[model samples]
Every structure is written in structure tokens, then in C-alpha cells.
Target chain A: MTSISIIGTGKMGSAIAEVAARAGADIQIIRRRAGAGSSLERGDAEYGLVGDQLTGELVVLAVPYEAYPSVLGHYRDRLDGKIVIDISNPIDFTTYDELLVPADSSTAVELSQALPAGARVVKAFNVNLGDTLSTGTNGTTTTTVLFAGDDPAAKIAVADLIEAAGLRAVDAGPLSRARELEAMGFLQIVLAAIGKTRYESGFALLQ
Target chain B: MTSISIIGTGKMGSAIAEVAARAGADIQIIRRRAGAGSSLERGDAEYGLVGDQLTGELVVLAVPYEAYPSVLGHYRDRLDGKIVIDISNPIDFTTYDELLVPADSSTAVELSQALPAGARVVKAFNVNLGDTLSTGTNGTTTTTVLFAGDDPAAKIAVADLIEAAGLRAVDAGPLSRARELEAMGFLQIVLAAIGKTRYESGFALLQ
Candidate 1:
């Protein structure tokens, strides 16, 4: 079984842990404190290794966009030679539809810049609702999850996790597509505001 | 029957025709040219007011965003005392995900300003897909269409047309919500590009 390490035990982080654990994968969770056994609770680790702390080939960053830089600083060393899946959207709640990041850059790009040498960053699960991720099924009719990364193997690894979670993994080319993906996320929220669509559920492309 | 005039007959315009006409409404379509009940063929009238002949309490601007200014200019005098629905989104196709209008201004806002005195402008039907309008049903489930306008009576009339076309109509409060609605349209395209969702459907609030 492929081993996985999940950072952040919040709503999305915990949900990813639960689903990944249930899918028959060996999962390790890193919290604020240190622990000896599996499934360490929050506030368990103090001054952890960037990449060496977790014994998994894949690491999932489930922190908020604002916390991304600090999270990377704490785990950059451990991240080298591992696939890092980014599921954060840098949204500016203050301005509603206006993006908080610069026009020429994206959060994924920012995270990539924060990574240590040889670290692979891939963006996925940014468009999906956290509630749906924890409760939905991956049976006959699976919802599509998009993944974009510079490394083909890294994308494949994340795609496997998405499929194992019972969803369809669609490769949306490279990391630049993350801009479009984040913009789509903003659009989804706007539609939800007007009661046109919901976060618990979303569109499935027919074409 | 409520008499309605559709100012453009393109794919979306034709889809609007299908919706309004199917509702048993007296529909008059002003194609590119001017004549006695002319077909939506090609180049009919010179930009504005197509022969200065139009008779309807309600007029739908079914043209492109680039043609919005000209369409508004032509109908300025004729649109007086009538309800005008602007179903256009000023999206910059060249930049893909960037907004064409300035940060403070929007396409609908511009149209509202260009209207003649006493004419009421409503922004609606800009988020729904043409195929969705044509199909009327999303995977065996009926969907909802949202609308926003400054005039209460005009919104009610538009809502009636939406219901007549076989979908639920949601009044998203005021015309200022148009910014949010237009952003939703942009998001739909982004989600569609990455295969995360279909643009042919909308969200319905349970509450």
C-alpha cells in the first residue's frame, strides 16, 4: 500500500485523512504536537522536519492560502523528492469576486516558489466542496477532480488518490491552469451567492 | 399573450426565442435586417433601431457584448417607457480569464447608463448556458434560472417568462448583484475548461 502524510487537521485535512485511510492506504497525520502512534491529534509536533518527519512518498497540504508560506517553511526540507498536492484557493473575502493575489501570479505558483529544491507541487481538489469530499461516493457515477502539475509522475500520484477516493481524476495540463481553476472556484462561489449553484454539489461537464 | 421583441437571433437569441415562443408569447424577432417579418438570416439593419420600427412593452437585447453600445444607441428613443433586459456579459475572450471592463464598471452598468429616460433596464439570463435553455431539464432534474434588476415590476415580468419556459426563477435582489452574477458566468467557463463541472446547469438553494 502507498503511504501518505496529511498536514492540517481542519475540515478539509481531516476529511482527506478519513477518506485516504478508508481507501486502504497507510496514512500519517502531522499536527501541532508530536505523537508516537498513528493519527496524531492537533498540536502534537513542535519544530518538525520539513520533509523527513513523514515517511510517505506523497504529502497533502490542506492549510489555508494565508498559512501556505509558513507551512512551506516548516516542511520544505522534507518536501524534496515528494509529490505535494495543493488544495487551497487564495480568496479575498473582503472584495467578494476580486482576487487577492497579483494578476500575473497564483497561489500555486507562490507555493511552488516556497518549495525546497526538487519538490514537486501539483494543484488538485481546489474546485471541490469539503463537505462533498468527506461524504460523497466514488461508485458508478464518479465526480471529476482536476489535477495540474509540472511533473507527470507527481500528477499521476495525486490522480491515483483522487480515483481511489471514488472520483474521476482529470489532468488539466500544467500548473498555469490553476489560475483558471481558481477563477472557476470564484465563479462557483458567486453562483452560490445568487442561489444559482451550490458548494455541496457542482457541475459535471457533459462534453 | 404578452408581446415581446427579441433584438438579436444568434444561438443564444434563438434559444431565448425557443423559450419565449414555446410559452405562447407573441414574439417579434428583429434579425440583422429590416423587412416584413424577416428571417434571422444576415446583415439586416444598420446597428441601431433597425428601420426605427419596434412595438413591444418588453425588449430583449440578445446581441453580443461588443455590439451592446450600438444596440443601446439604436433603441435609445424607442426603448422609452419599455422594459429592457440585458443578457450580455462583457468577458474578454482575448485574455481568457481576465475581465474586459474596468474594476469599478460593468457591462450591465454601462447599458443601464445608456438607456433613455423612463426606460427600465434589467440584467438577467446571462449565466445560463444556451444548451441548458434549449434542453430545459438537467439530468431528469429541473433547474433554476436567476435574474437581477433595479425595477420590481420588470423583474416580475421576466420571472414569469422564465417560469413559462419551464424553470424556476430566482430574484437575486438588485442590479448591483449583476457584478456577482457576471463573475459567476466567468467561473462557469473556468470550471468547464478543466472538466470539473458542466455549465449547462445551476444551483438551487434548499432554504
Candidate 2:
């Protein structure tokens, strides 16, 4: 049984927990406040929140892009030998036109640089909408989950989580691909405006 | 009956034609070839191999981003006093990570400057995907179409067409909003790799 812990229990955080729980993973959640959808009976899901930090195989950071630095800083010490999945898309909500991160670098790439020397931070789940995360298939349209990271092992672990959620996992090359993946959200915004597609609306990768 | 001419016959151009034809509009398609989907013989719809050199009340430029200058050059003379709709997003496909258009200006702005003083250029429909453009509603979800223009009258005309296509026309403010709307496609590209969202995605502007 793979033990998994999810930080941030908002819509996406809760949805991930619900799906992971249903999939029979030892799901644990940590939130700012103690509530119904809470994962653990302790403090936050940071590294120091638990006695052991690097015990779990995977840690899904479902927090906002703005809070990434603080989250990483608080948990960096304990993230060694574990996969850190960054699912936040650094969008400048103020303008909604410009990306907050530098043009040359993506939020995921920046996070990788900030993490511990051996800590693996993979980009995943930033593209999918929280509303449409369904474990069951909707006809022939199987959901596509994209992930990217320098560490192959970490990428595989994250991919397994996506597969466990009943969606197909696609390895979208290296960490640089995160830039493209992050920009991909713009497409969803367009489709979402027309009510023709859903946040969970995904594409079939044709080579 | 409003006389509308589509300046390109690509996937997006054809999809718009299909919607326009279904909505009982007089559509003139300007394409290089006449084919099955061509509306040449419909009598209601006209087919012209020539570009938008001579235009009517509405002229939709559905050409690729790079072909904008040539298209504008070809049609600039006839575009005077006409309502020109720009549906092109300046996407740098070569460098998937970067935007080709300068940070200060957008493609729509460039086109606006290129057009005659009398011609009204409105930026609309660039964010919509050809795949999700169906005549009917997707169950209870209503389609939201976005439009932006310096001229209110031009915006209204484009909005009217959007409504005829079974979607709600939203005024995304002034022509500068085109920059935000154009950047939206790049964001969509990022989401596509993740395969969790669709091309027609957009956000609702609420009070």
C-alpha cells in the first residue's frame, strides 16, 4: 500500500483526496483549519508537521502558485528522497494576460531549483480543473494526465497517482515542457468561456 | 439580411461558416479550393477564391497569424467603412515556450493600425476552438463568446453573430483586452499537454 499525503484541502485538494481515498491509497490530508475533509489530525502537511518527513513516496502540493515558496521553505528540509509534485500554474490573476513567472522559466522549474539538492519536484495536475476530476470514465474519452520532471523515478510515482485516479498518464518530456503545459491552461480558459468544454476537458495526444 | 464574408477556409473558418449557415446568415467563403463543405452552390452562401479585397458589412479574417500582414495588405483598400473582425492569435509555434508578439502590443492592435480609418476592427472568436463549435447547446451549459473592439457598434455586430451561433456574447471591455484574450490561446496550449482541459475553455466575467 503506497502511503500518500496531500497538502491544501480546497476544491482541488479535496478532490484529489476523495479520488485517492476511493482508489484505496492510504490517503492523508492536511489543511489550515480542522474540518470535515481534513486529511490528518495534526497540523499542516509540511515536512515538520509529521515526525518523519521523507517517509512518504509522494507529496502532492495542491496549494496556490503564490504560496509555493512558503510551502517549499517550510518543507524543504524534510523533502529529501521523496517526490515533490508542483501542481500550481503561476498565473498573474491581476492582469490575467501575463504569466507571473519569468518568460524563460516556469513555476515548476523554479521550484526544482529551490528544492533540496536531491529533492525531486515534478510538474503535474496544474492543467486539470478540480470540478471535472472524475474517477469513472465518460464514454471513450479517457482523461489525459501530463507530468514532467528531471527525476524519472519521481515522474513515475506521480504518473502512478494519476493512473490510480482512473486517467491515462502522459510523460510530457522534461521540466522545460512545464512551460508549454502551463500555457496550455489558456486553451481551457477559452473552452470554458464557451461552455463547450470542462476544466476536466482533456485532449488526445496524436503523434 | 447581413452580408458576411469569411476571409479564410481553414478549420476555424469552416466551423464558423457551418455555424453561420445554420443560423440563417448569408456567408461568402473566400478559399483557394471549392470542396464538399464549400458553400458555393448554396446560393445563400458565396464562394470566392479571391481574398477580402472587396468587402461588405462584415469581414472576418481567419487567416494564420503569420499571414496577417499579407491578408491585411490584400484587403486594406476594400476594408474601408467595413466591420473587420480579427480572429487570429499570434502564437509562436516554433518556440512553444515564448510569445512572438511584443509585450507592449498585440496582433489585434497591429491589425487595427493597418486598417483604414473608416474600417472598424473588432477582436473576437480567437479563443474558441473549432472542435467545440456545435450549433446546439451542451445540455444546460450555455456557450459564452467573448468580443473586444474600440468601436461599440462593431462589437455589437460581432456579438449579434455570436448569439446567433447559440452562444452568449460577452463584451470583454476595450480593444486592449484583445491582448488578454490573445494570450488566452497560449494558456490553452499549456493545458492541452496535460490533456485535462479543452480548447474552448474560458472564464465567465461576472459582476
Candidate 3:
């Protein structure tokens, strides 16, 4: 069984936890500083504090893009030899007019650069809404998770996790392709925020 | 019956012609110069020369973004009282690294400003691949055409045209929202180019 550690207890974090638990992975919910030890109401997953040793090989940073710096600072070299998933769409929330990251790079790429060399960064779940991820469906269509990274093994692991949860997973090429995924995610969020589309569903990649 | 004059016989133009013809719209195919006047081999669209007057009220600029200047200059003041559909994704095709227009504006907005005040500019079809539009399906799912414009009447006309062709048309908010649609379209094209996804299939907006 693949062990997973998801940081942040926001909507995205909770949604991913629901799916990961459904996939029967050993789940660890890390909420920045920690909360009620193990809340069975959310999921039957282990809850950890900031200072706790990162146990799961697959660690997901489900926090907002702004939290990466602090999270990485605390974890630092501890993230070595782990599969770090970056699911943040680094868009400006204040004006919703621009993205915070460099035009050429994505949050995932930036996260990878900050993490230890041994940490494999995979870009996934950034393109999905929290509601869609939790429901595992975009209306009648099964939620399709698009992921990208340089490591084949890391991509396979994340794909397996998503697929095991009764969702669809797609490999969107190298980590550089995260730029396109970020664009798609940003567009979806903007549409939802403006009431042009629904947050419960998003742009589905139908086969 | 609505008449559509498509400028450029490229894949996108031809694909749109197929749908518009099926929709029972009178089609007028206008190449850069002239064609074998009304070739029935390529749908029943009437072929016309550059000097010919646009008979269709719905003028589709199916040409590449680069040709917009010349096309607009040629028919500058002539597009009055017409509904012009701008389907060009203004991306730098040479490297696919950047979009050609300003970050705050879209090609449709630019076209709207360049044309006569009476002419209504609608942004549509830039989000779809020619093959998907031609087949009216993105694999098992029907192709959903996303359109945006300030004029509700123009949107209704385009929506009616799309629905008549057995495809889905979605209103993606005001003309300013074309930025998001362009981003989506650009992502799809880049994915196809990198073999991450198929050209015949695209991001389906499944309800």
C-alpha cells in the first residue's frame, strides 16, 4: 500500500484526503500546525503536527501557493527522497488579473527548485476544483486528474493513486508542461469565480 | 437562413463550413484570392474572389492571426452591420512560447476596435481543433463550442448556428472573457503538439 502525507487542511487538502483514503492508501493529514489528533469525521487518516517526522514517501503540498516558502522552510532537507506533489495554481487572488509566478515557470517548477534534490516534484490536482476532486466526478464524467513531471516513477505513483480512487489520470508530458496545466486551472477558477461556470465541475478531459 | 462568409479555406475554416452548412446556413468560401467559383466538392459553399462583396451577414475570419491586418484593411469600412466571428488564437506559432496580443486584450477585442461600430465581433471556435469541430465530436462526447461577446444577439445567432449543427454552444461571459478561452485553446494546441493529447479530442465542458 502506498503511504501518503497531505499538507494543509483546506478544501483541496480535505478533498484529496477523501480520495486518498478511498484509494486505501496510508493517509497522513498535516495541517500546517496540527489539529485534533485524528479526526475520523474527515477521514480515517493519521494527523500530524509541524514537527512530526514526514512518514509518507508521497507528500502532497495541498496548501495555497503562498504557503510553499514557509512549508518548505520547516520541512527543508526532510523532504529528500520523497514524491512531493505541488497542486497550487499561483494566481493573484486580490485582483484575479495576473499569476504570481514567473511567466515561463509554474508553481510546481518553483516548488521543485526549492525542495531537496532527492525530492521528485509532480504537478497534479492543480487543474481540479476541490468540489470536483471530492465528488470524484465532473457531473456525469469521472474527474480526470492531469499530472506532469520528469520522473516516470513519480508520475506512475500519482496516477495509480488517482486511478485507484475511481478517478481518471492523464500524463501531461514533462514538468515544463505544468505551465499549460496552470493556465487551464487559472481559467477554470476565473470562470467559476465570475459565475461563468460551476466550481462543482470543471473542464473535463473526455476520451 | 443565416449566411456565413468564411475567409480562408484552411482546416479551421473548412471545418466550420462543414458545421454551418449542416446547420442549413448559406456558405460562402473566400480564399485569399479566388477559387474554382463554387466547387461542390468542398460542401455547397459559394466560392468568391477577393474583390467580391461579402454576401453573408456572419463573416468568419478563419484566416491566421497574421493575415488579420491585410484582411481588415481590404474590407475596413465594408464590415458595417455584420456579425464578425473572430476564431483566431493569437499565439506565437513560431515557438508557441507567447501570445501575440496584449495581456489585457484578446484578438476579438482588437478586431472589434478595428471594425465599424455597427459590426459586432464575437469570439468563438478558437478553443476547438479543426478536426473536432469537423466531426462534431470530441471522441464519444459532442464538441462544445465556447463563445463570448458583448452582444447577446450575436451570441444567440452563433449558439443557434452551433446547436443547429448538432454541437453544443456555451456562453463564456462577456467579450473580455475571451482571454480565458484563448488560454484554454492555447493549452489544448500545445498538448496536441507535444503528443500529450489527440487533436481529434479536446477538453470537454461536460455538464
Model number with the top lDDT = 3
Task: Give each model's whole-structure lDDT.
Answer: 0.68, 0.66, 0.84
- Flag the better candidate by lDDT, 1 or 2: 1
Candidates 2 and 3 compared by TM-score, better number: 3
* lDDT of candidate 3 over B16-102, digit per residue (tens): 999998899999888786443233247477888665799898999988899999998788788888999999888898977567887
Clashing pairs in 3: none
The positional error of residue B183 in candidate 3, measured at the CA in angstroms, is 2.7
Interface root-mean-square deviation, candidate 3: 2.9
Measured with C-alpha atoms, the lDDT of residue B88 in candidate 1 is 79
| Alpha-carbon TM-score of each model against the true structure | 0.73, 0.70, 0.82
Residue A105 lDDT, candidate 3, scale 0-100: 77
Write down the RMSD of all candidates, one decimal each. 5.6, 5.9, 3.6
Question: Which tens-of-lDDT digit does each residue in A1-207 have in candidate 2?
Answer: 466777776777766665566556676565544454433333323322422344457777878888877676667777777788787777776655556787567788898888778888898877666654544332234555667788888888777777777776777668876766675554445445555454445333221
Model 1 Cα displacement at A76 (Å)? 4.6
Task: Report residue B192 deviation for candidate 2 (angstroms).
Answer: 8.5
* Cα lDDT, model 1, residue B15: 74
Name the best candidate (by TM-score).
3
How accurate is chain B of model 3, given as a TM-score from 0 to 1? 0.95
lDDT of 2 by residue, B107-179 (tens): 7888888888988889887766665455333222454566778998888888878777777777766787676
Q: In candidate 1, what are the lDDT values of residues A58-156, reduced to their tens digit?
A: 888877788777776777877888888888777777766466666456677777877875889898877666655766532213456667788888888
Q: For each prediction, how big is the interface RMSD?
A: 6.1, 9.3, 2.9
